[model samples]
Target: MNGSHETEIRELMKSYFDGLYHSSSDILRTVFHPDLAYVNGTTGNYEHLDFEEYMARIDARTPPASRGDVREEIIERIAFKGDRIGIVEARMTMMGRNYQDLLTIINTDDGWRVLTKVFSFVERKA
Candidate 1:
Protein backbone atom coordinates (compact mmCIF):
# COMPACT_ATOMS: atom_id res chain seq x y z
CA MET A 1 0.00 0.00 0.00
CA ASN A 2 1.06 3.55 -0.53
CA GLY A 3 2.17 5.68 2.38
CA SER A 4 -0.92 7.87 2.20
CA HIS A 5 -3.28 4.92 2.24
CA GLU A 6 -1.45 3.42 5.15
CA THR A 7 -1.61 6.71 7.01
CA GLU A 8 -5.32 7.01 6.39
CA ILE A 9 -6.00 3.51 7.60
CA ARG A 10 -3.82 4.09 10.63
CA GLU A 11 -5.81 7.17 11.51
CA LEU A 12 -9.06 5.30 11.09
CA MET A 13 -7.86 2.52 13.36
CA LYS A 14 -6.68 5.07 15.84
CA SER A 15 -10.14 6.55 15.82
CA TYR A 16 -11.56 3.10 16.47
CA PHE A 17 -9.27 2.58 19.46
CA ASP A 18 -9.93 6.05 20.82
CA GLY A 19 -13.66 5.56 20.47
CA LEU A 20 -13.56 2.29 22.34
CA TYR A 21 -11.34 3.77 25.02
CA HIS A 22 -13.55 6.81 25.53
CA SER A 23 -16.92 5.23 24.65
CA SER A 24 -17.49 8.02 22.21
CA SER A 25 -20.30 7.34 19.78
CA ASP A 26 -19.37 10.15 17.45
CA ILE A 27 -15.85 8.93 17.03
CA LEU A 28 -16.98 5.37 16.51
CA ARG A 29 -19.56 6.42 13.97
CA THR A 30 -17.00 8.37 12.04
CA VAL A 31 -14.86 5.32 11.36
CA PHE A 32 -17.51 2.62 11.16
CA HIS A 33 -20.02 2.46 8.37
CA PRO A 34 -23.71 2.65 9.22
CA ASP A 35 -24.34 -0.82 7.80
CA LEU A 36 -21.54 -2.37 9.77
CA ALA A 37 -21.93 -6.02 10.70
CA TYR A 38 -19.96 -7.13 13.74
CA VAL A 39 -19.75 -10.78 14.67
CA ASN A 40 -18.31 -12.51 17.71
CA GLY A 41 -18.62 -16.16 18.68
CA THR A 42 -16.07 -16.42 21.44
CA THR A 43 -18.74 -16.85 24.12
CA GLY A 44 -20.01 -20.16 22.70
CA ASN A 45 -22.87 -18.59 20.78
CA TYR A 46 -22.82 -16.93 17.42
CA GLU A 47 -23.67 -13.31 17.93
CA HIS A 48 -24.08 -10.41 15.58
CA LEU A 49 -24.60 -6.72 16.13
CA ASP A 50 -25.17 -3.82 13.85
CA PHE A 51 -23.57 -0.44 14.17
CA GLU A 52 -26.36 1.02 16.25
CA GLU A 53 -26.43 -1.86 18.70
CA TYR A 54 -22.68 -1.71 19.08
CA MET A 55 -22.74 2.00 19.71
CA ALA A 56 -25.49 1.57 22.26
CA ARG A 57 -23.40 -0.98 24.09
CA ILE A 58 -20.52 1.42 24.09
CA ASP A 59 -22.75 4.12 25.50
CA ALA A 60 -23.97 1.86 28.28
CA ARG A 61 -20.51 0.85 29.43
CA THR A 62 -18.21 2.88 31.60
CA PRO A 63 -15.10 3.82 29.64
CA PRO A 64 -12.04 1.91 30.70
CA ALA A 65 -9.96 5.05 30.65
CA SER A 66 -12.25 6.67 33.19
CA ARG A 67 -11.80 3.71 35.52
CA GLY A 68 -8.01 3.93 35.33
CA ASP A 69 -7.90 0.76 33.27
CA VAL A 70 -4.56 0.65 31.54
CA ARG A 71 -5.05 0.44 27.81
CA GLU A 72 -2.81 -0.53 24.91
CA GLU A 73 -3.55 -1.02 21.22
CA ILE A 74 -1.48 -2.29 18.34
CA ILE A 75 -2.35 -2.52 14.69
CA GLU A 76 -0.99 -5.89 13.73
CA ARG A 77 -1.43 -5.75 9.98
CA ILE A 78 -3.25 -4.16 7.08
CA ALA A 79 -3.74 -5.85 3.76
CA PHE A 80 -5.48 -4.64 0.66
CA LYS A 81 -7.01 -6.54 -2.16
CA GLY A 82 -7.50 -3.52 -4.35
CA ASP A 83 -7.92 0.21 -4.06
CA ARG A 84 -11.21 -0.18 -2.25
CA ILE A 85 -10.98 -3.19 0.05
CA GLY A 86 -8.68 -3.61 3.02
CA ILE A 87 -8.39 -5.78 6.10
CA VAL A 88 -6.89 -4.82 9.46
CA GLU A 89 -5.99 -6.86 12.49
CA ALA A 90 -5.41 -5.27 15.86
CA ARG A 91 -5.06 -6.17 19.52
CA MET A 92 -6.30 -3.97 22.30
CA THR A 93 -6.51 -3.82 26.08
CA MET A 94 -9.63 -2.51 27.74
CA MET A 95 -11.80 -3.20 30.77
CA GLY A 96 -9.09 -5.45 32.18
CA ARG A 97 -9.46 -7.70 29.19
CA ASN A 98 -7.54 -8.29 25.98
CA TYR A 99 -9.22 -8.27 22.60
CA GLN A 100 -8.16 -9.03 19.07
CA ASP A 101 -10.24 -7.67 16.24
CA LEU A 102 -10.19 -8.20 12.51
CA LEU A 103 -11.70 -5.28 10.73
CA THR A 104 -12.72 -5.11 7.11
CA ILE A 105 -12.43 -1.64 5.70
CA ILE A 106 -13.48 -0.14 2.39
CA ASN A 107 -12.60 3.06 0.69
CA THR A 108 -15.78 4.78 -0.33
CA ASP A 109 -16.46 8.09 -1.95
CA ASP A 110 -16.57 9.66 1.46
CA GLY A 111 -13.35 8.09 2.66
CA TRP A 112 -12.20 4.90 4.34
CA ARG A 113 -14.88 3.24 6.46
CA VAL A 114 -14.83 0.17 8.59
CA LEU A 115 -17.28 -2.31 7.10
CA THR A 116 -17.19 -5.11 9.63
CA LYS A 117 -15.51 -6.40 12.76
CA VAL A 118 -14.93 -9.92 14.02
CA PHE A 119 -13.38 -9.98 17.45
CA SER A 120 -12.47 -12.15 20.39
CA PHE A 121 -11.91 -11.14 23.97
CA VAL A 122 -10.30 -12.83 26.96
CA GLU A 123 -10.92 -11.73 30.50
CA ARG A 124 -7.82 -11.52 32.67
CA LYS A 125 -7.83 -13.54 35.86
CA ALA A 126 -7.18 -11.60 39.00
Candidate 2:
Protein backbone atom coordinates (compact mmCIF):
# COMPACT_ATOMS: atom_id res chain seq x y z
CA MET A 1 0.00 0.00 0.00
CA ASN A 2 1.17 3.48 -0.68
CA GLY A 3 2.04 5.38 2.46
CA SER A 4 -0.46 8.08 1.61
CA HIS A 5 -3.17 5.52 1.00
CA GLU A 6 -2.43 3.84 4.32
CA THR A 7 -2.59 7.14 6.12
CA GLU A 8 -5.87 8.10 4.48
CA ILE A 9 -7.42 4.72 5.19
CA ARG A 10 -6.41 4.91 8.83
CA GLU A 11 -8.07 8.28 9.08
CA LEU A 12 -11.18 6.89 7.44
CA MET A 13 -11.30 4.09 9.99
CA LYS A 14 -11.03 6.62 12.77
CA SER A 15 -14.08 8.39 11.41
CA TYR A 16 -15.84 5.07 11.11
CA PHE A 17 -15.11 4.13 14.71
CA ASP A 18 -16.23 7.51 15.94
CA GLY A 19 -19.41 7.33 13.90
CA LEU A 20 -20.43 4.05 15.46
CA TYR A 21 -19.54 5.19 18.94
CA HIS A 22 -21.60 8.30 18.54
CA SER A 23 -24.26 6.80 16.24
CA SER A 24 -23.79 9.84 14.08
CA SER A 25 -24.89 9.25 10.52
CA ASP A 26 -23.47 12.58 9.50
CA ILE A 27 -19.98 11.50 10.46
CA LEU A 28 -20.48 8.11 8.84
CA ARG A 29 -21.56 9.73 5.59
CA THR A 30 -18.14 11.31 5.27
CA VAL A 31 -16.39 7.93 5.26
CA PHE A 32 -18.85 5.69 3.41
CA HIS A 33 -19.79 5.63 -0.21
CA PRO A 34 -23.31 6.71 -1.08
CA ASP A 35 -23.92 3.31 -2.62
CA LEU A 36 -22.48 1.25 0.20
CA ALA A 37 -23.59 -2.30 0.90
CA TYR A 38 -23.95 -3.52 4.42
CA VAL A 39 -24.23 -7.24 5.06
CA ASN A 40 -24.28 -9.63 7.99
CA GLY A 41 -24.98 -13.34 8.53
CA THR A 42 -23.93 -14.14 12.06
CA THR A 43 -27.40 -15.47 12.89
CA GLY A 44 -27.27 -18.08 10.07
CA ASN A 45 -29.53 -15.97 7.85
CA TYR A 46 -28.10 -13.62 5.34
CA GLU A 47 -29.12 -9.99 5.59
CA HIS A 48 -28.30 -7.01 3.47
CA LEU A 49 -28.77 -3.26 3.62
CA ASP A 50 -28.09 -0.32 1.42
CA PHE A 51 -26.60 2.89 2.70
CA GLU A 52 -29.90 4.51 3.59
CA GLU A 53 -31.13 1.53 5.51
CA TYR A 54 -27.89 1.30 7.42
CA MET A 55 -28.02 4.93 8.30
CA ALA A 56 -31.58 4.65 9.45
CA ARG A 57 -30.61 1.89 11.84
CA ILE A 58 -27.75 3.93 13.10
CA ASP A 59 -29.99 6.92 13.59
CA ALA A 60 -32.48 4.92 15.60
CA ARG A 61 -29.94 3.41 17.93
CA THR A 62 -28.84 4.93 21.19
CA PRO A 63 -25.24 5.98 20.87
CA PRO A 64 -22.71 4.04 22.90
CA ALA A 65 -21.27 7.33 23.96
CA SER A 66 -24.63 8.39 25.35
CA ARG A 67 -24.75 5.19 27.38
CA GLY A 68 -21.30 5.85 28.80
CA ASP A 69 -19.91 2.68 27.26
CA VAL A 70 -16.16 2.38 26.93
CA ARG A 71 -15.17 2.48 23.28
CA GLU A 72 -12.85 -0.19 21.86
CA GLU A 73 -11.82 -0.16 18.25
CA ILE A 74 -8.97 -1.71 16.31
CA ILE A 75 -7.79 -1.76 12.74
CA GLU A 76 -6.63 -5.34 12.48
CA ARG A 77 -5.33 -5.42 8.89
CA ILE A 78 -5.19 -3.48 5.67
CA ALA A 79 -4.28 -4.65 2.16
CA PHE A 80 -4.43 -3.10 -1.25
CA LYS A 81 -5.68 -4.70 -4.45
CA GLY A 82 -4.27 -1.88 -6.50
CA ASP A 83 -3.80 1.84 -6.13
CA ARG A 84 -7.52 2.56 -5.88
CA ILE A 85 -8.86 -0.41 -3.95
CA GLY A 86 -8.24 -1.75 -0.47
CA ILE A 87 -9.60 -4.09 2.15
CA VAL A 88 -9.67 -3.50 5.88
CA GLU A 89 -10.39 -5.81 8.78
CA ALA A 90 -11.51 -4.05 11.92
CA ARG A 91 -12.88 -4.87 15.33
CA MET A 92 -15.03 -2.80 17.66
CA THR A 93 -17.09 -3.24 20.77
CA MET A 94 -20.38 -1.38 21.19
CA MET A 95 -23.84 -1.89 22.58
CA GLY A 96 -22.78 -5.01 24.45
CA ARG A 97 -21.48 -6.74 21.35
CA ASN A 98 -18.03 -7.36 19.97
CA TYR A 99 -17.96 -6.95 16.19
CA GLN A 100 -15.55 -7.80 13.45
CA ASP A 101 -15.98 -5.96 10.17
CA LEU A 102 -14.55 -6.59 6.73
CA LEU A 103 -14.62 -3.31 4.92
CA THR A 104 -14.02 -2.89 1.20
CA ILE A 105 -12.75 0.57 0.41
CA ILE A 106 -12.25 2.48 -2.78
CA ASN A 107 -10.39 5.64 -3.53
CA THR A 108 -12.72 8.03 -5.26
CA ASP A 109 -12.45 11.62 -6.26
CA ASP A 110 -13.69 12.37 -2.76
CA GLY A 111 -10.87 10.26 -1.29
CA TRP A 112 -11.15 6.85 0.38
CA ARG A 113 -14.62 5.70 1.24
CA VAL A 114 -15.97 2.43 2.49
CA LEU A 115 -17.74 0.74 -0.40
CA THR A 116 -19.05 -2.19 1.53
CA LYS A 117 -19.12 -3.57 5.02
CA VAL A 118 -19.64 -7.20 5.95
CA PHE A 119 -19.73 -7.71 9.66
CA SER A 120 -20.48 -10.22 12.41
CA PHE A 121 -20.76 -9.81 16.12
CA VAL A 122 -21.06 -11.82 19.30
CA GLU A 123 -23.01 -10.64 22.29
CA ARG A 124 -20.81 -9.70 25.17
CA LYS A 125 -21.14 -11.65 28.40
CA ALA A 126 -22.90 -9.76 31.12
Candidate 3:
Protein backbone atom coordinates (compact mmCIF):
# COMPACT_ATOMS: atom_id res chain seq x y z
CA MET A 1 0.00 0.00 0.00
CA ASN A 2 2.90 2.32 0.77
CA GLY A 3 4.19 2.21 -2.77
CA SER A 4 0.76 2.86 -4.22
CA HIS A 5 -0.31 5.81 -2.12
CA GLU A 6 0.97 8.39 -4.57
CA THR A 7 -0.64 6.69 -7.51
CA GLU A 8 -3.87 6.44 -5.60
CA ILE A 9 -3.84 10.14 -4.83
CA ARG A 10 -3.12 10.92 -8.48
CA GLU A 11 -6.11 8.88 -9.51
CA LEU A 12 -8.25 10.64 -6.94
CA MET A 13 -7.21 13.97 -8.39
CA LYS A 14 -7.93 12.85 -11.91
CA SER A 15 -11.38 11.74 -10.84
CA TYR A 16 -11.95 15.06 -9.12
CA PHE A 17 -11.44 17.10 -12.29
CA ASP A 18 -13.31 14.60 -14.38
CA GLY A 19 -16.19 14.98 -11.99
CA LEU A 20 -16.22 18.70 -12.58
CA TYR A 21 -16.08 18.20 -16.31
CA HIS A 22 -19.16 16.03 -16.20
CA SER A 23 -20.81 17.80 -13.22
CA SER A 24 -21.30 14.43 -11.69
CA SER A 25 -20.91 14.99 -7.98
CA ASP A 26 -20.94 11.26 -7.50
CA ILE A 27 -17.40 11.08 -8.78
CA LEU A 28 -16.52 13.63 -6.15
CA ARG A 29 -17.94 11.33 -3.52
CA THR A 30 -15.21 8.90 -4.43
CA VAL A 31 -12.42 11.43 -3.91
CA PHE A 32 -13.15 13.62 -0.91
CA HIS A 33 -13.62 12.90 2.75
CA PRO A 34 -16.64 14.13 4.68
CA ASP A 35 -14.66 16.98 6.16
CA LEU A 36 -12.72 18.33 3.21
CA ALA A 37 -11.70 21.95 2.61
CA TYR A 38 -11.56 23.90 -0.65
CA VAL A 39 -10.12 27.34 -1.45
CA ASN A 40 -9.95 29.31 -4.64
CA GLY A 41 -9.83 32.90 -5.92
CA THR A 42 -13.35 32.71 -7.23
CA THR A 43 -14.74 32.82 -3.73
CA GLY A 44 -13.58 36.51 -3.65
CA ASN A 45 -13.58 35.65 0.03
CA TYR A 46 -12.03 32.62 1.61
CA GLU A 47 -14.06 29.74 2.95
CA HIS A 48 -12.89 27.00 5.27
CA LEU A 49 -15.84 24.75 4.91
CA ASP A 50 -16.25 21.01 5.41
CA PHE A 51 -17.39 18.42 2.88
CA GLU A 52 -21.04 19.34 2.96
CA GLU A 53 -20.19 22.96 2.45
CA TYR A 54 -17.96 22.07 -0.43
CA MET A 55 -20.52 19.79 -2.03
CA ALA A 56 -23.28 22.36 -1.66
CA ARG A 57 -21.19 24.86 -3.55
CA ILE A 58 -20.55 22.37 -6.29
CA ASP A 59 -24.17 21.37 -6.36
CA ALA A 60 -25.41 24.94 -6.42
CA ARG A 61 -23.06 26.25 -9.02
CA THR A 62 -22.68 25.14 -12.61
CA PRO A 63 -19.33 24.93 -14.35
CA PRO A 64 -18.92 25.40 -18.08
CA ALA A 65 -18.86 22.09 -19.86
CA SER A 66 -15.24 21.01 -20.04
CA ARG A 67 -14.00 24.50 -20.65
CA GLY A 68 -10.42 23.72 -19.75
CA ASP A 69 -7.97 20.98 -19.19
CA VAL A 70 -7.85 19.43 -15.77
CA ARG A 71 -4.45 20.97 -16.38
CA GLU A 72 -3.75 19.71 -12.89
CA GLU A 73 -0.19 18.71 -12.10
CA ILE A 74 1.78 16.36 -9.92
CA ILE A 75 4.59 18.79 -9.12
CA GLU A 76 5.68 17.45 -5.76
CA ARG A 77 4.78 14.43 -3.67
CA ILE A 78 5.46 13.42 -0.09
CA ALA A 79 4.32 10.48 1.97
CA PHE A 80 3.93 10.88 5.71
CA LYS A 81 5.36 8.81 8.52
CA GLY A 82 2.27 6.65 8.54
CA ASP A 83 2.54 6.23 4.78
CA ARG A 84 -1.21 6.65 4.83
CA ILE A 85 -0.98 10.42 4.85
CA GLY A 86 0.26 12.09 1.68
CA ILE A 87 0.63 15.67 0.52
CA VAL A 88 0.65 16.64 -3.13
CA GLU A 89 1.42 19.97 -4.80
CA ALA A 90 -0.16 20.41 -8.18
CA ARG A 91 -1.43 22.99 -10.65
CA MET A 92 -4.59 23.11 -12.68
CA THR A 93 -5.71 25.19 -15.63
CA MET A 94 -9.39 25.84 -15.31
CA MET A 95 -11.34 28.18 -17.53
CA GLY A 96 -8.09 29.83 -18.57
CA ARG A 97 -6.97 30.29 -14.99
CA ASN A 98 -3.79 28.78 -13.66
CA TYR A 99 -4.06 27.30 -10.20
CA GLN A 100 -1.71 25.79 -7.72
CA ASP A 101 -3.44 23.42 -5.37
CA LEU A 102 -2.25 21.68 -2.28
CA LEU A 103 -3.97 18.39 -1.74
CA THR A 104 -3.86 16.49 1.51
CA ILE A 105 -5.22 12.99 1.64
CA ILE A 106 -5.20 9.84 3.69
CA ASN A 107 -5.30 6.24 2.59
CA THR A 108 -8.19 5.20 4.75
CA ASP A 109 -9.92 1.87 5.23
CA ASP A 110 -11.99 2.55 2.16
CA GLY A 111 -9.17 3.81 -0.05
CA TRP A 112 -7.41 7.09 -0.78
CA ARG A 113 -9.59 9.98 0.31
CA VAL A 114 -8.79 13.65 0.06
CA LEU A 115 -8.86 15.41 3.41
CA THR A 116 -8.36 18.90 2.03
CA LYS A 117 -7.79 20.77 -1.21
CA VAL A 118 -6.55 24.36 -1.19
CA PHE A 119 -5.85 26.37 -4.30
CA SER A 120 -4.58 29.82 -5.23
CA PHE A 121 -4.09 31.50 -8.57
CA VAL A 122 -0.65 31.91 -10.07
CA GLU A 123 -0.09 34.85 -12.36
CA ARG A 124 2.32 34.30 -15.17
CA LYS A 125 4.88 37.02 -15.72
CA ALA A 126 4.89 38.44 -19.20
Candidate 4:
Protein backbone atom coordinates (compact mmCIF):
# COMPACT_ATOMS: atom_id res chain seq x y z
CA MET A 1 0.00 0.00 0.00
CA ASN A 2 1.29 3.42 -0.85
CA GLY A 3 1.41 5.74 2.13
CA SER A 4 0.57 8.80 0.06
CA HIS A 5 -2.48 7.14 -1.48
CA GLU A 6 -3.66 5.97 1.90
CA THR A 7 -3.33 9.44 3.33
CA GLU A 8 -5.21 10.97 0.44
CA ILE A 9 -8.01 8.42 0.73
CA ARG A 10 -8.22 9.01 4.49
CA GLU A 11 -8.58 12.71 3.95
CA LEU A 12 -11.28 12.09 1.38
CA MET A 13 -13.15 9.87 3.83
CA LYS A 14 -12.96 12.56 6.47
CA SER A 15 -14.46 15.03 4.03
CA TYR A 16 -17.22 12.55 3.25
CA PHE A 17 -18.08 12.10 6.91
CA ASP A 18 -18.06 15.82 7.54
CA GLY A 19 -20.23 16.44 4.49
CA LEU A 20 -22.91 14.07 5.73
CA TYR A 21 -22.76 15.44 9.25
CA HIS A 22 -23.16 18.96 8.01
CA SER A 23 -25.22 18.10 4.94
CA SER A 24 -22.87 20.21 2.89
CA SER A 25 -23.20 19.42 -0.78
CA ASP A 26 -20.36 21.74 -1.61
CA ILE A 27 -17.98 19.75 0.53
CA LEU A 28 -19.30 16.47 -0.81
CA ARG A 29 -18.84 17.56 -4.42
CA THR A 30 -15.11 17.70 -3.89
CA VAL A 31 -14.96 14.08 -2.90
CA PHE A 32 -17.58 12.37 -5.02
CA HIS A 33 -17.29 11.99 -8.76
CA PRO A 34 -19.91 13.62 -10.96
CA ASP A 35 -21.19 10.23 -12.10
CA LEU A 36 -21.08 8.54 -8.74
CA ALA A 37 -23.69 6.03 -7.78
CA TYR A 38 -25.30 5.70 -4.38
CA VAL A 39 -26.94 2.36 -3.72
CA ASN A 40 -28.57 0.68 -0.75
CA GLY A 41 -30.27 -2.66 -0.27
CA THR A 42 -30.96 -2.68 3.42
CA THR A 43 -34.59 -3.28 2.69
CA GLY A 44 -35.86 -6.09 0.49
CA ASN A 45 -35.86 -3.74 -2.48
CA TYR A 46 -32.87 -2.00 -3.95
CA GLU A 47 -32.54 1.74 -3.81
CA HIS A 48 -30.29 3.62 -6.17
CA LEU A 49 -29.51 7.25 -6.78
CA ASP A 50 -27.27 9.03 -9.18
CA PHE A 51 -25.03 11.86 -8.07
CA GLU A 52 -27.59 14.58 -8.79
CA GLU A 53 -30.42 12.87 -6.96
CA TYR A 54 -28.20 12.12 -3.98
CA MET A 55 -26.98 15.68 -3.78
CA ALA A 56 -30.53 17.00 -4.00
CA ARG A 57 -31.56 14.81 -1.10
CA ILE A 58 -28.61 15.96 0.94
CA ASP A 59 -29.38 19.55 0.19
CA ALA A 60 -32.94 19.14 1.39
CA ARG A 61 -32.13 17.30 4.62
CA THR A 62 -31.84 18.83 8.05
CA PRO A 63 -28.24 18.28 8.97
CA PRO A 64 -27.44 16.14 11.96
CA ALA A 65 -25.26 18.92 13.31
CA SER A 66 -28.26 21.23 13.42
CA ARG A 67 -30.15 18.70 15.52
CA GLY A 68 -27.22 18.21 17.89
CA ASP A 69 -26.85 14.59 16.91
CA VAL A 70 -23.58 13.13 18.07
CA ARG A 71 -21.18 12.54 15.19
CA GLU A 72 -19.60 9.11 15.00
CA GLU A 73 -17.46 7.78 12.17
CA ILE A 74 -14.77 5.19 11.63
CA ILE A 75 -12.71 4.12 8.65
CA GLU A 76 -12.61 0.41 9.22
CA ARG A 77 -10.38 -0.51 6.30
CA ILE A 78 -8.85 0.73 3.05
CA ALA A 79 -7.59 -1.55 0.32
CA PHE A 80 -6.21 -0.80 -3.08
CA LYS A 81 -6.46 -2.91 -6.20
CA GLY A 82 -3.75 -0.83 -7.83
CA ASP A 83 -2.53 2.72 -7.95
CA ARG A 84 -5.82 4.10 -9.22
CA ILE A 85 -8.47 2.05 -7.47
CA GLY A 86 -9.34 1.86 -3.80
CA ILE A 87 -12.05 0.45 -1.60
CA VAL A 88 -12.92 1.90 1.77
CA GLU A 89 -15.06 0.31 4.43
CA ALA A 90 -16.45 2.81 6.86
CA ARG A 91 -19.12 3.22 9.50
CA MET A 92 -20.98 6.30 10.63
CA THR A 93 -24.04 7.31 12.58
CA MET A 94 -26.60 9.84 11.36
CA MET A 95 -30.32 10.35 11.17
CA GLY A 96 -30.91 7.93 14.04
CA ARG A 97 -29.18 5.11 12.25
CA ASN A 98 -25.79 3.45 12.11
CA TYR A 99 -24.53 3.17 8.53
CA GLN A 100 -22.00 0.81 7.05
CA ASP A 101 -20.59 2.17 3.81
CA LEU A 102 -18.51 0.49 1.14
CA LEU A 103 -17.04 3.22 -0.94
CA THR A 104 -15.26 2.61 -4.24
CA ILE A 105 -12.81 5.32 -5.14
CA ILE A 106 -10.68 6.11 -8.12
CA ASN A 107 -7.71 8.32 -8.64
CA THR A 108 -8.96 10.73 -11.21
CA ASP A 109 -7.17 13.55 -13.03
CA ASP A 110 -8.56 15.84 -10.36
CA GLY A 111 -7.67 13.55 -7.42
CA TRP A 112 -9.24 10.74 -5.46
CA ARG A 113 -13.01 10.71 -5.75
CA VAL A 114 -15.61 8.26 -4.62
CA LEU A 115 -17.08 6.51 -7.65
CA THR A 116 -19.71 4.41 -5.95
CA LYS A 117 -21.12 4.13 -2.49
CA VAL A 118 -23.05 1.06 -1.43
CA PHE A 119 -24.38 1.41 2.07
CA SER A 120 -26.75 -0.06 4.63
CA PHE A 121 -28.00 1.21 7.95
CA VAL A 122 -29.81 -0.01 11.03
CA GLU A 123 -31.90 2.19 13.28
CA ARG A 124 -30.25 3.16 16.52
CA LYS A 125 -31.85 1.82 19.65
CA ALA A 126 -33.10 4.22 22.24
Instruction: Give the TM-score comparing model 1 with the true structure, all chains together.
Output: 0.95
Question: Which one wins by lDDT: 1 or 4?
Answer: 4
The lowest-lDDT stretch of 10 consecutive residues in candidate 3 is: 66-75
The top-ranked prediction according to TM-score is 4
In candidate 4, which residue pairs clash?
Answer: none
Segments of candidate 2 deviating more than 4 angstroms: none
> Model 4, 78: alpha-carbon shift in Å?
0.2
Task: Compute the lDDT for candidate 2.
Answer: 0.94
Summing lDDT over every window of 10 consecutive residues in candidate 1, give the lowest-scoring window. Answer: 38-47
The superposed Cα distance between candidate 3 and the true structure at residue 25, in angstroms, equals 1.5
Which model is ahead, 2 or 4, in terms of TM-score?
4
Question: TM-score for every candidate vs. truth?
Answer: 0.95, 0.96, 0.76, 0.97
TM-score for predicted model 3 compared with the true structure: 0.76
Model 1, span 22-91: residue lDDT tens: 9999899999999999898578846999989999998998988899788899999999988899999999
Where model 4 places Cα greater than 4 Å from the true spot, the runs are: none
> CA lDDT of each candidate?
0.91, 0.94, 0.70, 0.95
Candidate 4 local distance difference test against the native? 0.95
